[model samples]
Target: MHQIKSKLLLTGAAVIVAFSFGLNANAARMDMVDVSNNNGYMSTAEYVSMRNEFGVKAVTVKISEGGTYKDPYAASNIANVQAAGLYINGYHFARYATKAQAIAEADFAGQTAKAAGLPVGAVLATDVESQEANNQTKTTNDRNNTAFMQEIAKFGYRSDIYTSGSWANNKMTIKGKTGWIASYPYVATGKNWYSTNHAWQWSSTAKFRISYGGFDVSQLNSTYYTADQKSSVKPTDPSAVHQNNQTANKHQQANSSAKWVKESKTYTLKTAVKLRTGASTSSSVITTLPAETTVKTDQAIIQGGYRWVRQPRFSGYGYLATGPANNTLEYVKISVSNTYYTVKSGDSWWSIAQRNGLSMYSLAHQNGKSIYSTIYPGNKLQIN
Candidate 1:
């Protein structure tokens, strides 16, 4: 009887452990879809139909080849996909080394994205395919390719390195913001390419029935935009300038009473407030304000010698200074949390927030910066 009882107890424990493992395995199965046509061969109607029918979440279009700028179709495709409500990102097929060549590719991609009015959702990716016939070029291609991504980041976009799961882990040391792994079945068995990635593309053929070949697979999807995210997607058309101006005026009216603080002691002011060619702070006279200035508890004080205030109410704490503040500071009591994240190459505000289980708004608020705010390796985030 003692032997029988012991046997029964062991059986029960085994069953319980098996059931727990099964549940966890099921939970780890994530649904992901990819929109990649390697040769710039996808049609516009096909792309649009896929987005509409399958609810595809993100699209990766090619912008360069052999370390040189090529293709006009990439811009139109990116625009059409974005207009249809899907997120858009770009990739470069790297096969070159000279810094000039890399910079050219980066500039070309940036110009195309700017023209299309598509804010890159991920870093402008560097796609390294092993089948290319140039072994000598391939030897130095990895380092040159990384340099290309860093150049692109200087243009205010993220850099996501793309390669097979095995190659990226074994051969590449991508120190950009993030890694974009292209492993099918969304599983990394031996050496996962994107071990430190914030997002992963797990499959190629899964579909939302978006015309048989397309599907949407993003973690977050919605039409509503917070003021900060909205500001990043400002209209580029000249005729819409008046409407944009009016909207800007309205935002100013809404946030006119908010306080302004500088992140740096010396900051440049753009003649205009857009991402391109706006005023920047010179190295001179970047100083902090006296403690008696009376900043609101919710407001951000810009440090680093730059003068700009974050408009938390209007733009969700990501908008940089348009100009100086017009009102006296008022303090508000709010609960705050200190958050820590290890910065990877190609990390953006969105990716960091998503990884650490925080909302973009909360992250920006705690750090007192905007969505476009620059963060480097080993930066600590404070969430208020």
Candidate 2:
């Protein structure tokens, strides 16, 4: 009788250990959800509630082509989700119109994601589905898919392609990046999309579980939250508000600089225009120049100004009257450098500086400009 009791006790202990192991395994899996088209633009409060309740680990928000209509909740929603301590990734619905179009669409989505300040774990995913007729155009679709992912990679974030098991295995051949396989047991036939994957969306309703994926799985529901959640957290950068104001100011400056008038003049001097005599004597001279003149332009000597010359009678050096200084001849009347820049749509002084491998402050200094200086499309900028 005693031996029977010992056996029963051992069996009960084994069961308890097995249950504990299962619970531990569940905690390790990555619990995620595809918020693609499912939530019809949830409000901040709704998002917060979902995070607080569900323990959702990650969310994949859908970004449509052309980004003509982005998730209204994207930026703020990401902030709220991050505040609730959840990971967020962006998914682009491939339009498959053209390779260029697909690339453009992905660019727009990546820009939006970066602008939202989504930190680590925010990847740009390409959502490949069979509904689009272009899906049959395997070559075109494949080309577009590859190009789109490449564009997303440029913005310092990883790329992923999200498709069903069968579509991923049979139709797509994404070479470099990871895949987020959509395997709904009810609908999916294949078991896994790839031998190596960064994530897997096994079922929409699956609870968050710890899987092979490094992150913890999120449970599906309105109340999902992740391990990253915290309460009443403020933005890391206190200067963000000030920086935003500064950006606005710089944008205004760019517009103002773009408005400057380029006039043809036959100055006795061969060099580009400098301030007219005493231009800085008072606010009057500075104000007289078209609003296109950059704000806080340096009084130091440099080449290039508001005037250009098509033809010159003499090529030899000659003295030209520059703006007012203690000595009229303070600035050397040297010819302007032909290196000029025509502003592009998203061109910023900082961006230009980065492209040219120049420091923002140094570029501004060399150009006799300020950080707040404005530039615009078609505006000619002197680059010496």
- C-alpha TM-score for every candidate: 0.40, 0.42
Predicted structure 1: lDDT: 0.41
Tens-place lDDT per residue, model 2, 2-76, is: 011111111111000111112222122223555532233444454343333332345666655454656655666
- lDDT string for model 1 (4-100, tens) is 1111111111001111112222122121233333223345565444433332334666666554456556766666655544445666766544556
> Which stretches in model 1 have alpha-carbon errors above 4 Å?
1-55, 67-69, 98-100, 115-117, 120-122, 130-142, 175-177, 185-195, 212-384
As a whole number from 0 to 100, the lDDT of residue 29 in candidate 1 is: 17
What lDDT score goes with residue 195 in model 2?
34
- Model 2 reaches what TM-score against the true structure? 0.42
Q: Given candidate 2, what's the lDDT at residue 130?
A: 27
CA lDDT, every prediction? Answer: 0.41, 0.43
What CA RMSD would candidate 1 show? 24.1
